[model samples]
Target: MLKKTDCCQGVVNRKDKDGNTALHRAAAKNYPQMLKLLLACKADKNVTNQAGLTALDVARGQVNNRESINILGVCSFAGVSTLYKLWQLIVKILTEASTEIFQDMDGISSDDRNALLVILGLLLTATYQAILSPPGGVWQGAVFIVAFFLTLGLLKPFPRGFKTALQVLLAFFAICFQASIYPIIPFYFYVPLVINIFIFLVFVIMMSMCTASRVSKISVMVLGCWLLVGVIYQSFASFGS
Candidate 1:
Protein backbone atom coordinates (compact mmCIF):
# COMPACT_ATOMS: atom_id res chain seq x y z
CA MET A 1 0.00 0.00 0.00
CA LEU A 2 2.96 2.26 0.44
CA LYS A 3 3.30 2.38 -3.39
CA LYS A 4 0.00 4.24 -3.53
CA THR A 5 0.83 7.92 -3.91
CA ASP A 6 -1.69 9.09 -1.29
CA CYS A 7 -0.62 6.50 1.31
CA CYS A 8 3.06 7.01 0.58
CA GLN A 9 2.79 10.78 0.79
CA GLY A 10 0.16 11.08 3.55
CA VAL A 11 0.33 8.47 6.33
CA VAL A 12 3.41 6.39 5.56
CA ASN A 13 5.36 8.44 8.01
CA ARG A 14 2.54 9.04 10.51
CA LYS A 15 2.96 7.89 14.13
CA ASP A 16 0.32 6.07 16.16
CA LYS A 17 -1.14 7.53 19.36
CA ASP A 18 1.80 5.91 21.16
CA GLY A 19 4.31 7.72 18.91
CA ASN A 20 5.39 4.57 17.01
CA THR A 21 5.84 5.20 13.30
CA ALA A 22 5.25 2.60 10.57
CA LEU A 23 8.95 1.84 10.63
CA HIS A 24 8.83 1.36 14.38
CA ARG A 25 5.97 -1.11 14.11
CA ALA A 26 7.72 -2.93 11.30
CA ALA A 27 10.86 -3.30 13.39
CA ALA A 28 9.02 -4.17 16.59
CA LYS A 29 7.03 -6.79 14.71
CA ASN A 30 10.22 -8.22 13.18
CA TYR A 31 9.02 -7.67 9.61
CA PRO A 32 12.19 -6.97 7.71
CA GLN A 33 10.46 -6.99 4.34
CA MET A 34 7.86 -4.50 5.54
CA LEU A 35 10.67 -2.47 7.07
CA LYS A 36 12.51 -2.31 3.74
CA LEU A 37 9.36 -1.32 1.93
CA LEU A 38 8.57 1.41 4.43
CA LEU A 39 12.13 2.66 4.28
CA ALA A 40 11.94 2.71 0.49
CA CYS A 41 8.79 4.82 0.82
CA LYS A 42 10.78 7.24 3.00
CA ALA A 43 9.30 6.30 6.34
CA ASP A 44 11.07 7.96 9.23
CA LYS A 45 13.18 5.36 11.07
CA ASN A 46 14.48 7.76 13.72
CA VAL A 47 11.04 8.57 15.13
CA THR A 48 10.92 7.64 18.79
CA ASN A 49 8.09 5.67 20.35
CA GLN A 50 6.50 6.51 23.69
CA ALA A 51 9.55 5.01 25.36
CA GLY A 52 11.98 7.03 23.26
CA LEU A 53 13.17 3.99 21.24
CA THR A 54 13.91 4.35 17.56
CA ALA A 55 13.07 1.56 15.11
CA LEU A 56 16.66 0.38 15.44
CA ASP A 57 16.37 0.31 19.20
CA VAL A 58 13.21 -1.74 18.97
CA ALA A 59 14.93 -4.12 16.57
CA ARG A 60 17.79 -4.67 19.00
CA GLY A 61 15.33 -5.55 21.75
CA GLN A 62 13.71 -8.27 19.65
CA VAL A 63 14.62 -11.64 21.16
CA ASN A 64 13.89 -14.13 18.37
CA ASN A 65 13.94 -12.45 14.96
CA ARG A 66 17.39 -10.92 14.48
CA GLU A 67 17.08 -10.29 10.75
CA SER A 68 15.15 -7.19 11.75
CA ILE A 69 18.14 -6.10 13.77
CA ASN A 70 20.48 -6.92 10.88
CA ILE A 71 18.32 -4.89 8.55
CA LEU A 72 18.61 -1.94 10.89
CA GLY A 73 22.44 -2.32 11.01
CA VAL A 74 23.27 -0.18 14.02
CA CYS A 75 24.82 -2.69 16.45
CA SER A 76 28.10 -4.52 15.79
CA PHE A 77 26.90 -8.11 16.30
CA ALA A 78 28.91 -9.54 13.39
CA GLY A 79 32.11 -7.86 14.49
CA VAL A 80 31.57 -8.92 18.08
CA SER A 81 30.96 -12.56 17.08
CA THR A 82 34.10 -12.65 14.99
CA LEU A 83 36.04 -11.13 17.86
CA TYR A 84 34.52 -13.68 20.25
CA LYS A 85 35.83 -16.59 18.17
CA LEU A 86 39.20 -14.93 17.74
CA TRP A 87 39.50 -14.35 21.48
CA GLN A 88 38.60 -18.00 22.13
CA LEU A 89 41.50 -19.06 19.94
CA ILE A 90 43.75 -16.56 21.68
CA VAL A 91 42.62 -17.93 25.06
CA LYS A 92 43.51 -21.44 23.95
CA ILE A 93 46.99 -20.25 22.98
CA LEU A 94 47.33 -18.43 26.29
CA THR A 95 46.21 -21.53 28.18
CA GLU A 96 48.90 -23.63 26.54
CA ALA A 97 51.53 -21.03 27.35
CA SER A 98 50.27 -20.29 30.83
CA THR A 99 53.09 -22.08 32.59
CA GLU A 100 55.81 -20.08 30.91
CA ILE A 101 53.99 -16.78 30.34
CA PHE A 102 52.39 -16.17 33.73
CA GLN A 103 54.45 -15.54 36.85
CA ASP A 104 55.69 -18.83 38.29
CA MET A 105 52.85 -20.56 40.11
CA ASP A 106 55.06 -21.42 43.03
CA GLY A 107 56.09 -17.85 43.69
CA ILE A 108 52.59 -16.56 44.44
CA SER A 109 51.80 -16.80 48.14
CA SER A 110 48.26 -17.51 49.38
CA ASP A 111 47.64 -13.86 50.13
CA ASP A 112 48.86 -12.77 46.71
CA ARG A 113 46.87 -15.42 44.91
CA ASN A 114 43.75 -14.43 46.79
CA ALA A 115 44.30 -10.82 45.90
CA LEU A 116 44.78 -11.66 42.23
CA LEU A 117 41.65 -13.74 42.25
CA VAL A 118 39.67 -10.86 43.70
CA ILE A 119 41.03 -8.50 41.10
CA LEU A 120 40.13 -10.86 38.26
CA GLY A 121 36.66 -11.33 39.67
CA LEU A 122 36.10 -7.58 39.76
CA LEU A 123 37.37 -7.21 36.20
CA LEU A 124 35.02 -9.93 35.01
CA THR A 125 32.05 -8.24 36.67
CA ALA A 126 32.91 -4.89 35.13
CA THR A 127 33.40 -6.35 31.65
CA TYR A 128 30.13 -8.25 31.81
CA GLN A 129 28.25 -5.08 32.74
CA ALA A 130 30.02 -3.04 30.10
CA ILE A 131 29.21 -5.56 27.39
CA LEU A 132 25.55 -5.78 28.32
CA SER A 133 25.09 -2.03 28.59
CA PRO A 134 28.03 -0.54 26.72
CA PRO A 135 28.85 3.18 27.06
CA GLY A 136 29.59 3.92 23.40
CA GLY A 137 27.51 0.88 22.39
CA VAL A 138 28.53 -1.12 19.26
CA TRP A 139 32.33 -1.30 19.20
CA GLN A 140 32.59 -0.55 22.89
CA GLY A 141 30.90 -3.85 23.67
CA ALA A 142 33.36 -5.50 21.30
CA VAL A 143 36.26 -4.10 23.29
CA PHE A 144 34.79 -5.25 26.61
CA ILE A 145 34.21 -8.75 25.25
CA VAL A 146 37.91 -8.94 24.40
CA ALA A 147 38.88 -7.81 27.88
CA PHE A 148 36.36 -10.22 29.43
CA PHE A 149 37.70 -13.29 27.66
CA LEU A 150 41.31 -12.24 28.13
CA THR A 151 40.79 -11.84 31.85
CA LEU A 152 38.96 -15.16 32.02
CA GLY A 153 41.86 -16.83 30.22
CA LEU A 154 44.29 -15.24 32.66
CA LEU A 155 42.29 -16.77 35.50
CA LYS A 156 43.03 -20.27 34.18
CA PRO A 157 46.60 -20.53 35.52
CA PHE A 158 45.71 -20.19 39.17
CA PRO A 159 46.23 -23.10 41.55
CA ARG A 160 43.76 -25.97 41.82
CA GLY A 161 42.75 -24.56 45.16
CA PHE A 162 40.82 -21.90 43.28
CA LYS A 163 38.82 -24.40 41.24
CA THR A 164 35.62 -23.18 42.88
CA ALA A 165 36.47 -19.62 41.97
CA LEU A 166 37.26 -20.70 38.43
CA GLN A 167 33.87 -22.40 38.11
CA VAL A 168 32.06 -19.25 39.25
CA LEU A 169 34.01 -17.14 36.79
CA LEU A 170 33.27 -19.56 33.95
CA ALA A 171 29.56 -19.46 34.66
CA PHE A 172 29.45 -15.66 34.49
CA PHE A 173 31.68 -15.69 31.42
CA ALA A 174 29.21 -17.96 29.67
CA ILE A 175 26.39 -15.54 30.49
CA CYS A 176 28.42 -12.63 29.14
CA PHE A 177 29.06 -14.65 26.00
CA GLN A 178 25.33 -15.16 25.56
CA ALA A 179 24.55 -11.46 26.04
CA SER A 180 27.21 -10.36 23.54
CA ILE A 181 25.84 -12.50 20.68
CA TYR A 182 22.37 -10.96 20.49
CA PRO A 183 23.11 -7.83 18.45
CA ILE A 184 23.11 -7.93 14.61
CA ILE A 185 26.01 -5.70 13.65
CA PRO A 186 27.48 -3.87 10.67
CA PHE A 187 30.56 -4.75 8.58
CA TYR A 188 32.76 -1.70 9.21
CA PHE A 189 33.15 -2.58 12.90
CA TYR A 190 35.61 -5.24 11.81
CA VAL A 191 38.33 -2.63 11.43
CA PRO A 192 38.79 -2.22 15.17
CA LEU A 193 38.06 -5.89 15.85
CA VAL A 194 40.76 -7.13 13.50
CA ILE A 195 43.33 -4.71 14.86
CA ASN A 196 42.65 -5.76 18.44
CA ILE A 197 42.79 -9.50 17.61
CA PHE A 198 46.02 -9.31 15.62
CA ILE A 199 47.75 -7.31 18.30
CA PHE A 200 46.55 -9.66 21.06
CA LEU A 201 47.72 -12.77 19.22
CA VAL A 202 51.11 -11.21 18.57
CA PHE A 203 51.36 -10.12 22.19
CA VAL A 204 50.63 -13.66 23.39
CA ILE A 205 53.11 -15.32 21.04
CA MET A 206 55.84 -12.85 21.92
CA MET A 207 55.29 -13.41 25.61
CA SER A 208 55.53 -17.18 25.18
CA MET A 209 58.71 -16.94 23.09
CA CYS A 210 60.36 -14.54 25.48
CA THR A 211 59.55 -16.76 28.45
CA ALA A 212 60.87 -19.80 26.54
CA SER A 213 64.26 -18.02 26.47
CA ARG A 214 64.04 -17.72 22.66
CA VAL A 215 63.99 -13.88 22.64
CA SER A 216 65.06 -11.02 24.84
CA LYS A 217 62.29 -10.47 27.42
CA ILE A 218 62.91 -6.72 27.53
CA SER A 219 62.73 -6.49 23.74
CA VAL A 220 59.40 -8.34 23.67
CA MET A 221 58.04 -6.09 26.41
CA VAL A 222 59.04 -2.98 24.49
CA LEU A 223 57.55 -4.30 21.27
CA GLY A 224 54.33 -5.25 23.07
CA CYS A 225 54.04 -1.76 24.55
CA TRP A 226 54.48 -0.13 21.15
CA LEU A 227 52.05 -2.51 19.45
CA LEU A 228 49.48 -1.82 22.16
CA VAL A 229 49.84 1.90 21.59
CA GLY A 230 49.44 1.46 17.85
CA VAL A 231 46.36 -0.71 18.32
CA ILE A 232 44.76 1.86 20.60
CA TYR A 233 45.34 4.59 18.03
CA GLN A 234 44.04 2.51 15.12
CA SER A 235 41.01 1.22 17.00
CA PHE A 236 39.88 4.71 17.97
CA ALA A 237 40.46 5.99 14.45
CA SER A 238 38.51 3.16 12.82
CA PHE A 239 35.71 3.23 15.37
CA GLY A 240 35.20 6.94 15.04
CA SER A 241 34.88 6.69 11.29
Candidate 2:
Protein backbone atom coordinates (compact mmCIF):
# COMPACT_ATOMS: atom_id res chain seq x y z
CA MET A 1 0.00 0.00 0.00
CA LEU A 2 2.95 2.35 0.72
CA LYS A 3 5.65 3.41 -1.75
CA LYS A 4 8.76 2.69 0.31
CA THR A 5 11.16 4.00 -2.31
CA ASP A 6 9.96 7.59 -2.30
CA CYS A 7 9.62 7.57 1.47
CA CYS A 8 13.11 6.21 1.94
CA GLN A 9 14.55 8.69 -0.57
CA GLY A 10 12.96 11.55 1.31
CA VAL A 11 14.91 10.57 4.44
CA VAL A 12 18.11 9.87 2.45
CA ASN A 13 18.11 13.37 0.93
CA ARG A 14 18.11 14.71 4.47
CA LYS A 15 16.25 16.16 7.40
CA ASP A 16 15.09 13.30 9.65
CA LYS A 17 14.31 13.11 13.35
CA ASP A 18 17.10 11.84 15.68
CA GLY A 19 19.33 11.79 12.53
CA ASN A 20 17.93 8.38 11.70
CA THR A 21 16.43 7.73 8.25
CA ALA A 22 13.67 5.53 6.86
CA LEU A 23 16.40 2.94 6.09
CA HIS A 24 17.01 2.72 9.81
CA ARG A 25 13.37 1.97 10.50
CA ALA A 26 13.20 -0.55 7.64
CA ALA A 27 16.24 -2.37 8.99
CA ALA A 28 14.95 -2.44 12.55
CA LYS A 29 11.56 -3.79 11.44
CA ASN A 30 13.14 -6.22 8.94
CA TYR A 31 10.87 -4.68 6.35
CA PRO A 32 12.14 -6.15 3.10
CA GLN A 33 9.71 -4.09 1.04
CA MET A 34 10.72 -0.81 2.60
CA LEU A 35 14.42 -1.65 2.50
CA LYS A 36 14.30 -2.54 -1.18
CA LEU A 37 12.47 0.68 -1.95
CA LEU A 38 14.90 2.75 0.06
CA LEU A 39 17.85 1.10 -1.64
CA ALA A 40 16.40 1.78 -5.10
CA CYS A 41 16.00 5.44 -4.19
CA LYS A 42 19.73 5.80 -3.50
CA ALA A 43 19.20 5.35 0.20
CA ASP A 44 22.84 4.29 0.59
CA LYS A 45 22.31 0.69 1.64
CA ASN A 46 25.96 0.68 2.70
CA VAL A 47 25.60 3.75 4.88
CA THR A 48 26.00 2.95 8.55
CA ASN A 49 23.98 4.59 11.29
CA GLN A 50 25.25 6.12 14.55
CA ALA A 51 25.33 2.55 15.78
CA GLY A 52 27.58 1.55 12.86
CA LEU A 53 25.08 -0.72 11.12
CA THR A 54 24.06 -0.63 7.45
CA ALA A 55 20.56 -1.37 6.24
CA LEU A 56 21.44 -5.00 5.59
CA ASP A 57 23.58 -5.13 8.69
CA VAL A 58 20.85 -3.62 10.87
CA ALA A 59 18.33 -6.07 9.44
CA ARG A 60 20.43 -8.84 10.88
CA GLY A 61 20.13 -7.42 14.40
CA GLN A 62 16.38 -7.90 14.63
CA VAL A 63 16.29 -10.52 17.40
CA ASN A 64 13.03 -12.31 16.66
CA ASN A 65 14.12 -12.12 12.99
CA ARG A 66 10.69 -13.03 11.73
CA GLU A 67 11.12 -11.56 8.26
CA SER A 68 14.81 -12.48 7.74
CA ILE A 69 14.14 -15.99 8.97
CA ASN A 70 11.31 -16.30 6.46
CA ILE A 71 13.65 -15.13 3.72
CA LEU A 72 16.30 -17.66 4.70
CA GLY A 73 13.76 -20.50 4.71
CA VAL A 74 13.32 -19.99 0.97
CA CYS A 75 17.04 -20.45 0.32
CA SER A 76 18.38 -23.88 1.17
CA PHE A 77 22.04 -24.68 1.81
CA ALA A 78 23.86 -27.28 -0.30
CA GLY A 79 24.06 -30.67 1.40
CA VAL A 80 25.27 -34.20 0.76
CA SER A 81 22.23 -34.95 -1.38
CA THR A 82 22.92 -31.96 -3.61
CA LEU A 83 26.60 -32.88 -4.01
CA TYR A 84 25.70 -36.47 -4.86
CA LYS A 85 23.24 -35.30 -7.48
CA LEU A 86 25.84 -33.04 -9.06
CA TRP A 87 28.38 -35.82 -8.97
CA GLN A 88 25.97 -38.14 -10.77
CA LEU A 89 25.26 -35.50 -13.40
CA ILE A 90 28.95 -34.86 -13.97
CA VAL A 91 29.55 -38.57 -14.42
CA LYS A 92 26.76 -38.85 -16.95
CA ILE A 93 27.97 -35.84 -18.91
CA LEU A 94 31.51 -37.15 -19.02
CA THR A 95 30.33 -40.59 -20.09
CA GLU A 96 28.38 -39.03 -22.94
CA ALA A 97 31.21 -36.75 -24.02
CA SER A 98 34.31 -38.86 -24.50
CA THR A 99 35.41 -41.98 -26.41
CA GLU A 100 39.20 -41.80 -26.39
CA ILE A 101 41.83 -43.28 -24.13
CA PHE A 102 43.37 -40.63 -21.84
CA GLN A 103 47.03 -40.01 -22.50
CA ASP A 104 49.32 -38.80 -19.76
CA MET A 105 50.57 -35.22 -19.75
CA ASP A 106 53.84 -36.54 -21.03
CA GLY A 107 54.23 -38.32 -24.37
CA ILE A 108 53.33 -41.49 -22.55
CA SER A 109 49.85 -42.97 -22.81
CA SER A 110 48.69 -44.20 -19.44
CA ASP A 111 50.67 -47.31 -18.58
CA ASP A 112 49.26 -46.64 -15.11
CA ARG A 113 45.62 -46.77 -16.20
CA ASN A 114 45.65 -50.57 -16.19
CA ALA A 115 47.00 -50.85 -12.67
CA LEU A 116 44.45 -48.36 -11.34
CA LEU A 117 41.62 -50.14 -13.12
CA VAL A 118 42.61 -53.45 -11.61
CA ILE A 119 42.83 -52.05 -8.10
CA LEU A 120 39.46 -50.33 -8.38
CA GLY A 121 37.72 -53.37 -9.83
CA LEU A 122 39.01 -55.69 -7.16
CA LEU A 123 37.92 -53.26 -4.44
CA LEU A 124 34.37 -53.26 -5.79
CA THR A 125 34.49 -57.04 -6.07
CA ALA A 126 35.49 -57.30 -2.43
CA THR A 127 32.88 -54.75 -1.32
CA TYR A 128 29.86 -56.94 -2.00
CA GLN A 129 31.38 -59.75 0.01
CA ALA A 130 31.96 -57.44 2.97
CA ILE A 131 28.47 -55.89 2.93
CA LEU A 132 26.54 -59.19 3.03
CA SER A 133 28.75 -60.44 5.82
CA PRO A 134 28.13 -57.71 8.42
CA PRO A 135 27.03 -54.18 9.29
CA GLY A 136 29.96 -51.84 8.90
CA GLY A 137 28.13 -48.52 8.70
CA VAL A 138 30.95 -46.26 9.87
CA TRP A 139 33.38 -47.93 7.54
CA GLN A 140 30.88 -47.43 4.74
CA GLY A 141 30.46 -43.73 5.46
CA ALA A 142 34.19 -43.28 5.65
CA VAL A 143 34.55 -45.03 2.32
CA PHE A 144 31.89 -42.84 0.76
CA ILE A 145 33.60 -39.66 1.93
CA VAL A 146 36.95 -40.78 0.63
CA ALA A 147 35.43 -41.68 -2.72
CA PHE A 148 33.66 -38.34 -2.93
CA PHE A 149 36.79 -36.34 -2.25
CA LEU A 150 38.66 -38.45 -4.76
CA THR A 151 36.00 -37.72 -7.33
CA LEU A 152 36.47 -34.01 -6.80
CA GLY A 153 40.15 -34.52 -7.34
CA LEU A 154 39.44 -36.43 -10.56
CA LEU A 155 37.29 -33.80 -12.26
CA LYS A 156 39.62 -31.91 -14.59
CA PRO A 157 39.84 -29.55 -17.52
CA PHE A 158 41.10 -32.37 -19.71
CA PRO A 159 39.31 -32.87 -23.02
CA ARG A 160 35.96 -34.65 -23.09
CA GLY A 161 37.24 -38.06 -24.24
CA PHE A 162 39.64 -38.51 -21.36
CA LYS A 163 37.06 -37.17 -18.97
CA THR A 164 34.55 -39.81 -20.00
CA ALA A 165 36.74 -42.72 -19.00
CA LEU A 166 37.30 -40.96 -15.69
CA GLN A 167 33.60 -40.36 -15.43
CA VAL A 168 32.82 -44.06 -15.80
CA LEU A 169 35.15 -44.62 -12.91
CA LEU A 170 33.56 -41.72 -11.10
CA ALA A 171 30.05 -43.08 -11.43
CA PHE A 172 31.15 -46.53 -10.40
CA PHE A 173 32.83 -45.16 -7.31
CA ALA A 174 29.93 -42.89 -6.41
CA ILE A 175 27.55 -45.82 -6.54
CA CYS A 176 29.78 -47.88 -4.34
CA PHE A 177 30.26 -44.99 -1.92
CA GLN A 178 26.55 -44.50 -1.55
CA ALA A 179 25.98 -48.21 -1.37
CA SER A 180 28.30 -48.48 1.61
CA ILE A 181 26.36 -45.79 3.45
CA TYR A 182 23.09 -47.60 2.98
CA PRO A 183 20.93 -48.64 5.98
CA ILE A 184 22.34 -45.45 7.39
CA ILE A 185 22.60 -45.60 11.09
CA PRO A 186 24.00 -47.75 13.88
CA PHE A 187 27.46 -47.64 12.32
CA TYR A 188 27.76 -51.42 12.12
CA PHE A 189 26.17 -51.92 8.71
CA TYR A 190 28.82 -51.30 6.08
CA VAL A 191 31.44 -54.02 5.92
CA PRO A 192 31.01 -53.98 2.15
CA LEU A 193 31.30 -50.19 2.11
CA VAL A 194 35.06 -50.13 2.49
CA ILE A 195 35.52 -52.28 -0.58
CA ASN A 196 33.44 -49.91 -2.67
CA ILE A 197 35.43 -46.98 -1.34
CA PHE A 198 38.67 -48.64 -2.32
CA ILE A 199 37.33 -49.13 -5.82
CA PHE A 200 36.51 -45.44 -6.11
CA LEU A 201 39.91 -44.28 -4.85
CA VAL A 202 41.89 -46.52 -7.15
CA PHE A 203 40.15 -45.30 -10.28
CA VAL A 204 39.93 -41.73 -9.07
CA ILE A 205 43.71 -41.72 -8.87
CA MET A 206 43.87 -42.96 -12.42
CA MET A 207 41.48 -40.22 -13.43
CA SER A 208 43.42 -37.57 -11.53
CA MET A 209 46.55 -38.48 -13.41
CA CYS A 210 44.78 -38.18 -16.73
CA THR A 211 43.02 -35.01 -15.68
CA ALA A 212 45.64 -32.95 -13.95
CA SER A 213 44.10 -29.47 -14.07
CA ARG A 214 45.62 -28.66 -10.72
CA VAL A 215 48.98 -26.98 -10.12
CA SER A 216 49.98 -29.97 -8.03
CA LYS A 217 50.31 -32.10 -11.17
CA ILE A 218 54.07 -31.72 -11.30
CA SER A 219 54.49 -32.99 -7.77
CA VAL A 220 52.19 -35.93 -8.40
CA MET A 221 54.13 -36.74 -11.53
CA VAL A 222 57.40 -36.60 -9.69
CA LEU A 223 56.06 -38.88 -7.00
CA GLY A 224 54.82 -41.36 -9.59
CA CYS A 225 58.25 -41.41 -11.24
CA TRP A 226 59.87 -42.03 -7.90
CA LEU A 227 57.52 -44.92 -7.25
CA LEU A 228 58.32 -46.36 -10.64
CA VAL A 229 62.02 -46.12 -9.87
CA GLY A 230 61.48 -47.73 -6.51
CA VAL A 231 59.63 -50.64 -8.10
CA ILE A 232 62.43 -51.26 -10.63
CA TYR A 233 65.05 -51.03 -7.91
CA GLN A 234 63.15 -53.47 -5.71
CA SER A 235 62.80 -55.91 -8.59
CA PHE A 236 66.54 -55.78 -9.30
CA ALA A 237 67.35 -56.18 -5.61
CA SER A 238 65.10 -59.24 -5.36
CA PHE A 239 66.75 -60.73 -8.43
CA GLY A 240 70.23 -60.17 -7.03
CA SER A 241 69.18 -61.71 -3.67
Candidate 2 lDDT score relative to the true structure: 0.47
- TM-scores of the models, in the given order? 0.31, 0.27
Q: Write the per-residue lDDT of candidate 2 for residues 64-163, one digit (tens) a residue.
A: 7667434422323435334645754664454333222233323323555344445545565465445545654345444444434433333444454565
- Residue 167 in model 2: shift from native, Å? 1.4
Q: Work out candidate 1's RMSD over C-alphas.
A: 21.8
Residue-wise C-alpha lDDT for candidate 1, range 1-241, written one tens digit per residue:
6553323534776778998888888888899899888777867565567887778888888888688887777543334534645754664565467545444644667777667657766765665566556342444444544544344434434543363355344534444443353342333777457646855765676555433333333445555666667667756766677
Model 2, residue 11: distance off in Å is 47
Clashes of each: 1, 10
Flag regions of model 1 displaced more than 4 Å. Answer: 1-96, 138-175, 178-185, 189-241
Reference-based lDDT, residue 135, model 2: 52
What is the lDDT, from 0 to 100, of the residue 13 in candidate 1? 64
Name the top TM-score candidate: 1
